[model samples]
Structures are given as structure tokens and as C-alpha cells.
Target: MKKLQRIFIYTFLSLAAIVSIFPFLWMLVSITNKSVDVTQGRLLPGTHLIENMKTLFATVDIVPALINSAIIAIITTILTLLLASLAGYGFEIHRSRGKDIVFTILLLSMMIPFAAIMVPLYRMFGSISDTAPFIGIDSLGAVILPTATTAFFIFFFRQNTKMFPKDLVEAGRIDGLSEIGVFFRIYMPTMKTTYAAAAIISFMNSWNNYLWPLVILQSPEKRTIPLLISNLGSSYSPDYGVIMSAIVIATLPTALVFFLMQKHFVAGMMGSVKG
Candidate 1:
């Protein structure tokens, strides 16, 4: 009976894993096949991989879109780590009246759906387009600004900060370090795993962000990877192979980022829970 139960568990886990991974497997296979072959549900790999890639690169503005995505994701990740860590450190370290109340409000704000404020955010950016073209609508700054830091990130950092040793801050202060110096030299280094986790999440969010960027950016050159992929499917006669190729390429960066920092991400999340 125990052997039968063990077999059942393993079989169930195997099925679940296959279900989760099938779409990605299909996508990779589709990229190597022609549009007709892909549409016909070919499960086997084909010889059209090079042809599809050549067409995708030769015809699409994938390179520019990739560059735009990289710029926004990188900048947003950096700003999020900086601002969220600072806020988290302060909330955890500084004792002040109504601090919990303020933090509560911030967390509640996350419950408000982005769709609810999309119009207002668009109008706000539109209102400033003429005065600040650099950060206005249709610009990369617009894409990065709204998502530079989120309530979830703040909450995440704050939770993780709870586990941090307060003695270090005191030690740094005793050593005559300023608040800024202590944060930069002591806090940042000690929280490397948390930062790594935050970075992975932030970068992935910014890279895959479509709605705000779609609404804000109108120019072709300003388009990011998601927007570019949307365009690939917009045509009346969409090429499945090319679309899959683009998707595979678009997926590579986030995949690479996650795998590279996977260890740190798990550790940081565990730290957050322990805190």
C-alpha cells in the first residue's frame, strides 16, 4: 500500500510538470516550423528555424524594441531597489507616531487596480507632455517612472528588513558613520540576497509591462518588447513562426535574469518569511 501511494504521488507530480511545461515546449517547436506547419499543430521540429529568424530580424524592429526594453527594465530595477530599500529601512528602524498608519495606507494602495487609475495617469502625463517632453507621453521615462517602485516592493523590503540586525546600524553610528554612509556601506551589503530578489522581480515586471507603455507610447521607435510582439500578431496574415521566434527572443532576457539570481531570490524570500 505504501509503494502504491508513492507511485501515485510521483505520477501526479509528473503530470503537473508536463502540463506546466507543454506550452513552452510547443512555442519552441513552433518557432522552428513554418506558419502553415505551426497552424496545423505540428509537434515535431522543422527545418525553418534559420528562415524564420532571418525574416524576423530582417523585417521587424526587434533590435530597437529590445534596446528600449533593456533601458527601461534596468533603470526601473535600480530605482526600485534604491527607493524601496530606503523606505523599508526607515520604516523598520525609525520609531515615529503614525508610521504604521502611513505604511498601511501604502499597502492598501496596492489593492487598487491599475486599470482604475490608467486614464488619470495618462491624462497626468499628457498634461505635462509639453512642459517636460523628456518624461512625458511616448517617452521611455514615462514607462519607467510609474513602475520605478511599487507598494509591493516596499512591503517586500520592509518585511525582509525586519530580520536585519539593528546592532549593525548602532555599530556604524558608534564608528562615526552618517545615516547615508551606514545605509550605503553597511545595510546594502548585508541585504544582498533581498536586493537580488527585488531586482529580479522589478526587472521582470518592467520588461513585461505592456498596458501602461501601450497606452503612453504611440511612436514605433518607443515600443518595448511586449508592444513589438503585439504588433507581430496584429497583421491580417500573421506569421506564426516569426511571432514565436520573437516571443522566444523576448523571453530569453527574463529567463536568464531569473536563472542567474534564482538562488538569491529563494534565499531572500525565505528571509522575508522568517522575518
Candidate 2:
């Protein structure tokens, strides 16, 4: 019976691994095949890799889109780390009704689907040029402004902050440190794992974000990788080889970020557990 159970568990794990990895393998194989061969489900790689890359570059301004994606992801990450950490620390340390209510409202905002509010958000941003000064339509600000206050990050930070030691806050206070100083010096330093986890998650989300940017960004120069991929997929009779190459390009950075930060991700959860 135990042997049968062991065999069953192994079989399940193998199946799951194959299911997860098959799509990426297929994508790689498709990249190496002619468009017709890929569409026909030729599971093996062909010698069309270089040709696919050439076609992709010829058809799309992938480099500029990559730059735009980088700018958005980097800025979003920094801003999210600063703002969300501040808010999280404030809510956890203050112990006030007002702050509690505000945090609840922020969490509630996360529950509201972005799709439902997307049109209204789009119109508000579109009129920014005429209605607001400096930040107008078609600017990077258009992409950055809407996402600056991330509700999910707020919740993540706040939950993680609950794990922080109040004794440290008291110690810092005794040393004549202000609340802000305690946060920046005492709390932030010890929460490196939390920050790493948040940074990875925020960076990936911003980097991969599509629908909002699709609605807000107007020019090809400002479009993100996902948007670029979408356009590539929509072209008249898209060459699967070229599309696969583009997917590979679009996926690499996020994969790298995830791999580098995975240890921190686990560490962050452990911090939360220790709280």
C-alpha cells in the first residue's frame, strides 16, 4: 500500500511538472520552426531561429518597447517600495481608528475589479492634459500616475509589518529617534526580505501590466512589451516564429527577476511567520 501511494505521488508530480513546462517547450520549438510548421503543431525544433528573430525585428520596434517597459517597471518598483512601506509602517505602529479605517478602505479598493473602473480611469487620465498641469495625455506620467498607489502592495506591506518588533520601535524612540527615523532606520533595515519580495512582485506586475497601459498609452514609442506582443499577434497572418521570439524576449526579464528574488520571497514569508 505504501509503495502504491509513493508511486501515485510521483506520478502526480511528474504530470504537474510536464503540464507546467510543456508550454514553454512548445514556445521554444515554435520559435525554431517556420510559421506553417508551428501552426501545424510540429513539436520538434527546426532551423528557423535566426530567421524568426530577423522577422520579429523587421516587423516590430522591440527595443523601444523594451526601454519603455524598463522605465515603467523600475519607477513603479521604487515608488511602491517607498510609499507602501511608509503606509504599512504607519498603520501597524499608530494603533488608531482613523488609520485602521483607511487601511480597510485601501484593501476594499483592491477587491474592486479594475475592469469595472477602467473606462472611468481612462477618461480621467485622458483629460489630464487639459484639466491638470504638467501631466497630460501620452506622457509616461499617464502610465505611472494611475499605478503609484498599489492597493495590493499596501496589504502585503501591512501584513508583513505586523511581524515587526515593537520593542525595536520603543528602543529607537528611547534613542530620540522620530517616527519616520525609526521606520527608515530601524524597521526598514530589518525587513530586507519583505522589501525584496515586494520589489520582485511589484516589478513583475508593472512590467507585465497590459490592459491599463493598453488603454492609457497611445503611441508605439510609449507602449510596453505586452502591448507590443499583442500588436505582433494581431498582424495580418502573424508568423508564429516571430511571435514566439517576441514572447521569449518579453518573458526573460520577469523570469530573471523572479529567479533572483525567490530566496527573498521565502525569507519574507518566514518573517511574517515569526511575527
Candidate 3:
């Protein structure tokens, strides 16, 4: 019976792994084949990779799109981590009614679909650009502003913070540290795993975000990777080889970030659960 169970589990896992990885494998195969060959289900690599890459780069402003994606993703990840962590720690440690209410509202915001809010958000951005004293429309800040406060990240941090040792905060306070200092010096250091997990999630979302970015960014010079990929696929006649190359390029950053975060992410989740 135990042998049968083990066999079943292994079979299930193998099937799952294949399901998850098949698309990526198909993408690589697509990159190596011509459009007709790819559509006809050629599953092997071909000599077309170099030609595909040449066409993709030549027809697209690949460099600028890549730079814009990297810039927005990195900035969004850093700011989301900082702000979300701060708010999470505050709500958890302060233990006040007002903050509790605010946290609940923030969590509720997570349930609101982006599609429902997108039009109003676009209008708000337009207003900010038109009347705001400082920044204007068509700026990168336009892309960054709407995402500064992410409900999901805030909730993730708050849940993780429940696992934080309050005794550490009390001890820091007893030692004459202010609330902010205690958060920075004591809590932050202890929650490295939590930060790692949050950073991964936030970075992936920001990096792969397409709709808001599509609406906010109007210039090809400032387009992101996802937009570039979509446009690459939608030109007069799509080139499967080139589109496949773009998918691979666009998918690499998130894959790298996931690998780096996975090492620490599981450990953090385990720690939180134990605490």
C-alpha cells in the first residue's frame, strides 16, 4: 500500500512538472522554428534562432522597452516593500482601533477588481497631470503613482508580522528606542525572510503588469516588455520565431527573481507558521 502511494505521488508530481514546464519548452522550440513550422507543431530547435532574434531586435525598440520595464519594476518593488512593511508593522505593533480599521479597509481594497477602477484611475491621473503643480502626464511617475499603495502586499506583510515577536519590540522600547527606531533596528532585521517573500511577489506583479502600463504609457520609447511583446505579436504579420524570442526575453527577469526569492521565501513561510 505504501509503495503504491509513493508511486502515485511521484506520478502526480511528474505530470504537474511537465504541465508547468511544457509551455516554456514550446516557447524555446518556437524561437528556433519559422512561423509555419511552429504553427505546425515542430517541437525541436532549429537554426532560425539567430534570424528570429535579428528580426525582433531590428523591428522593435527592445533596448528602451527593457530599460523602462527594469526601472519601473525595481522602483515599484522597493517602494512597495518599504511602504507595505511600514504599514504592516504599524498596524500589528501599535494595536489601535484606528489602524485596525484602516488595515481592514486596505484588505477590502484587494477584492476590488482593477477593471472596475481603471477608468476612474485614468481620469484621476489625467486630473493630476493637468492640475498638479509638479508632475505632468506622459511621465514615468504616471506609471509609478497608481501602484504605490498595493492592498495585497500590505495584507501579506501584516499577516507575516503577526509572526513577529512582540517581546523584541517591547525590549527595544525598554532600551529607549523610539517606535520607528525599534521597527527599523529590531523588527526589520528579524523579518528578512518576510521581506524577501514580499519583494518577490511585488516585483513579479510590477514587472508583468500590462493593463495599467498600457493605459498610462503612450510612447514607444517608454513602452514596457509586455506591451512590446504584444505589439510584436500583432504587427501586420506575426513572426512566431520573433514572438517566441520576445516571450523568452520578457519571462527571464521574473524567473530570475523567483529563483532568488524561493530560497528565502519558503523558509520565511515556515518560520511564520511555526511562530
**Among all candidates shown, the one with the greatest TM-score:** 1
Lowest-scoring 10 consecutive residues by lDDT in candidate 3?
Answer: 266-275
- Give the better candidate number (1 or 3) by lDDT: 1
Instruction: Tell me each candidate's RMSD, in Å, in order.
Output: 1.7, 2.4, 2.9
Candidate 2 weakest ten by summed lDDT: 266-275
Q: On lDDT, who's better, 1 or 2?
A: 1
**In candidate 3, what are the lDDT values of residues 1-275, reduced to their tens digit?**
99999999999999999999999999988989888999888998888988988988898788899998888888888898899899878888888998888888878887899999988887777887867723345667777777877877777777888888889999999999998999999988999878888777667778889998898778688799989988877888788888888899899887776676677656544533343
Q: Pick the candidate with the highest lDDT.
A: 1
Q: In candidate 2, which residue ranges exceed 4 Å CA deviation? A: 1-5, 131-134, 266-275
- Higher-scoring candidate on TM-score, 1 or 2: 1
lDDT for each candidate structure: 0.91, 0.85, 0.83
Per-residue lDDT value at 52 in model 3: 89
Sorted by TM-score (best first), the order is 1, 2, 3
Question: Cα deviation in Å at residue 208, candidate 3?
Answer: 0.7
